[model samples]
Target: MSLCEAEKTFILHGVEENFRIDGREREDYRPMEVEIGIISHAFGSARLRLANTDVLVAVKIEVDTPYPEKPSQGKLDFFVDCSANATPDFEGRGGEDLATGISNSLSDAYRSSKAFDLKKLCIMKGQKCWKLLVDILLLECGGNLYDAVSLAVKAALWNTRVPGVKSVGIDGKNVELNVSERLNDCVPLDVSGAPVMVTVCKIGEYCVVDPSAAEEKCSSAALVVAVSQGNITTVLQGSAGSLHPTTLMDSLGLGVEVANQLNIALMETLQSAPPHFDVGFLK
Candidate 1:
């Protein structure tokens, strides 16, 4: 979304005063709603709405051979699809670049061994492993896309249930396996250390989290930080604007602090969420 010069000036003054046009403080976030296991066909799925932004994520698993170098580790691939309904810029192939960027960012955040344990997905030393395909679909764009997508992905992963292997037989060059069909036999994915991403946007001389589209347009720089288990996993500069060393440090600090809070709130919601009959896009 585009903002006029006067609108940008107004947003900047609000930031300088630690008050946004929406009457929120610098660290305040918009109201959020989350639903899990919403897609019946997916192994796991989640839908998250942060204010006007909406994101859906699904996890599917398949049996595949483990990588030669990391025979004990399985694979995880991230894919992001931006629907034409999200925004005018997302129509046709316009969102391809943003989708790719989000996918890559997610991959980088989860690449660290401490962020996600791939060994949990291994079925055998080298012959068999469960490959997780994480698909993220953007249904709407209100702003703070990175943070919203990251939260939905983490929730979807947490909801994923990996099939149990009933039996495995290996010959010299071939292997046979029996996967359990009982739904109760599935194993839940462990996402305790999954990273939570936060975007800190610099407006005027102050930084803010969960910036609206108009607020985003007023900012010249932004930093996307992913934190897991109280450790910073990834720190990406998302804008072309360069930040001073002090501003960069402050932004990182804010990102980590906000991420910690977000993680706690997200887990609380996931654990307490009741069965949802109404799932999918909300009109």
Candidate 2:
């Protein structure tokens, strides 16, 4: 967690007036900064900062044999690494559990066929296919990790450019093809169903969105809602304690409403990002 009980009350009161601790409204998202194509070695890369939490996502595309069961489809894997820079508690593999949890959650969120189409990445029937590895690096943990990570993933995907295929020459004994010409060409991935995770903290019977560390500690429990295109993708209950059924439902509804607005703001921001935008850090 990131503030104190008094600080939380101040934030809550600000929210009640449609203002936030950062001087934004409940509907207004924190100033988001994005940087694309930052990694020269990776196929695509992006860095996103939402208030304090900073997340970097890089896309690495590789060629591999398609899975036997899903030969016609490609694969998109998600991996989250919790860097020790965020906190000392994550030192020496101590953060493995949390890292794995975040990665697995992302895999589940994108596993549905309807969420992300993989067939477009298939090159051969069962021989070769493109696999996209999405690696997420956590730079800071000032709170609101879920929202920040999801936004970074979406931006990285948008910046991704899959290498195009030149030609396919298959022989009975050995199959050899020429692909050098198409190495420079690339196609962008469609991320329309990119899901956003919204956390609704239940603090003294009131729900708070995007809580800071202190606000998180002040709350009894929280609900994690993954929403894609205004639809509920997944719902997870967090915090150290449990909650009443009615409160859970209320949190979910609030999350959905906030998620829709968040998605819209993200889309607008990405669209407005300039081609040669600068990375804003130390901010």
Candidate 3:
């Protein structure tokens, strides 16, 4: 993502004029396509394409003993795999650092109880709980990785269905549970407060949302804002250069506004998504 001095100057000028190379406004985002329930074997899955960046998220659930400290709450883990198919740089363990960063950001965003209710995943208080493993695969990288990954993760969780526990039996020192046999009886996860990330890139004196790879390269500093139901869940700064306090505040405001708008649009799209089909990279 290296850029020449002249290229950086050009991008800075474009930001000043409020016109990007892609003809989008500073606050506007690229076109996004979302598909849900694309994986049959998993409890739920979704694929999201934001321009050239592609992400796939799958949710798997398992019953296990609840954590001693948070007995009433279940566990949520995030695993990100940057496939080599996305780029040659991701071959072998080359992408491990990036994958770890993304996964850690997701964990921070969803750690707040206000963002996600883990208590609902508890099956029997401290005795049993449902552990959800959210696996994210980065199939492509065009930029704005944080935003794309968050959106795909939210969509997958929205489509996830947890089987209903019919009953729990205690015989001697053993405990057995019965799950609902009918698929329709399963309960869908509540994803109303799932976080959506918005990356605010500082180009010269102005800030932009959803920057392309080129724009990102020219950015002096960037903030990855995670918004959940109008409240900010996390704020992470990645700076190539220093930022003024006032400018940072302004960028935060812009990121929150854009993230709210994105969340609304994403919810509407998810509600109206078509039935599951085989539309992956093959399409």
Candidate 4:
């Protein structure tokens, strides 16, 4: 990921000319591929590949008591694992820091009620609730990890189905519940307001979206912007660098615009996707 002076200069000149080394415009994203329902055991799963960046996400549900304060709402948790298969640098516990950072960012992005509704996951006022555990596995890393992870997580949640409750009864001091026996008797998660992240990288005086590995090395500063339903849910500054007030404002504008477009494209692709087949890394 290190770039020499000459390589950095080349990238800077290309950005100034509005053409990247990969032949992409400033706001253009690399080609993306998405697949859903890849994991049979999990309630829902999805895999996304943006160029060389690969991410897999799965959603698991467990019945548990709701928190005292938020008894009316369910729980959502994010976990990220950077597999060593992606890079030798991630072996052992080396990837823990990176994984924690990504998971924290996801939690912040989904914290707002406008971004995701936990009430739909609630089964009872205080006795019981469904806790969603979103697990993200990073299989490969080319660049733009934040954007790819967010998209994959959103897609997996969209594909998740919660089984319908057949009945809820109180027996003694315990709450009893029965779930539907039929496999098809389930409810799909609503993800219309799920946030999509866009990483804006600053090189020279220009800003670029979806930076490749080389582009990332040349960046002085970067911002990861999360947009949900045309509104910004979170803004995270990444790596080491400082930005002027005007430059930061401009980057925010660009990030929001790019994120909006990315969200639309992802939704269309998910809707038009055909019946699933075995198209994992083997493909």
User: Among these predicted structures, which one has the highest TM-score?
Assistant: 1
Question: Candidate 4, which ten residues in sequence have the lowest lDDT sum?
Answer: 274-283
Tens digits of per-residue lDDT for model 3, 1-283: 5789998888899999999988888988888888899999999999999889999999999998899999999999999999998977798889999999999999999999989999999988778899999999999999999999999999999999999999998887666889997999899999999999999988888899998988989888899999998899999886657679999889888888988898888887777655484223211
TM-score of 4: 0.96
Alpha-carbon runs more than 4 Å astray in model 2: 1-28, 173-177, 180-184, 276-283
Query: In what order do the candidates fall by lDDT, top score first?
Result: 1, 4, 3, 2
Off by over 4 Å in 4: 275-283
Cα-based RMSD of the predictions, in order? Answer: 2.5, 3.1, 2.7, 2.5
Cα displacement (angstroms), candidate 4, residue 123, comes to: 0.3
lDDT of 4 at 39: 91
Q: Candidate 1 on 109-201: residue-level lDDT in tens?
A: 999989999999899998899999999999999999999999999889988899999999978788998999999999998898899999999
> What total of clashing residue pairs does each candidate reach?
0, 4, 0, 0
Which of the predicted structures, 2 or 4, would earn the higher TM-score when compared with the native?
4
lDDT tens digits, residue span 189-222, model 4 = 9899999999999999989999998899999999
Weakest 10 consecutive residues of candidate 1 by summed lDDT: 274-283
- Where does candidate 2 have its weakest 10-residue lDDT segment? 274-283
Candidates in descending TM-score order: 1, 4, 3, 2
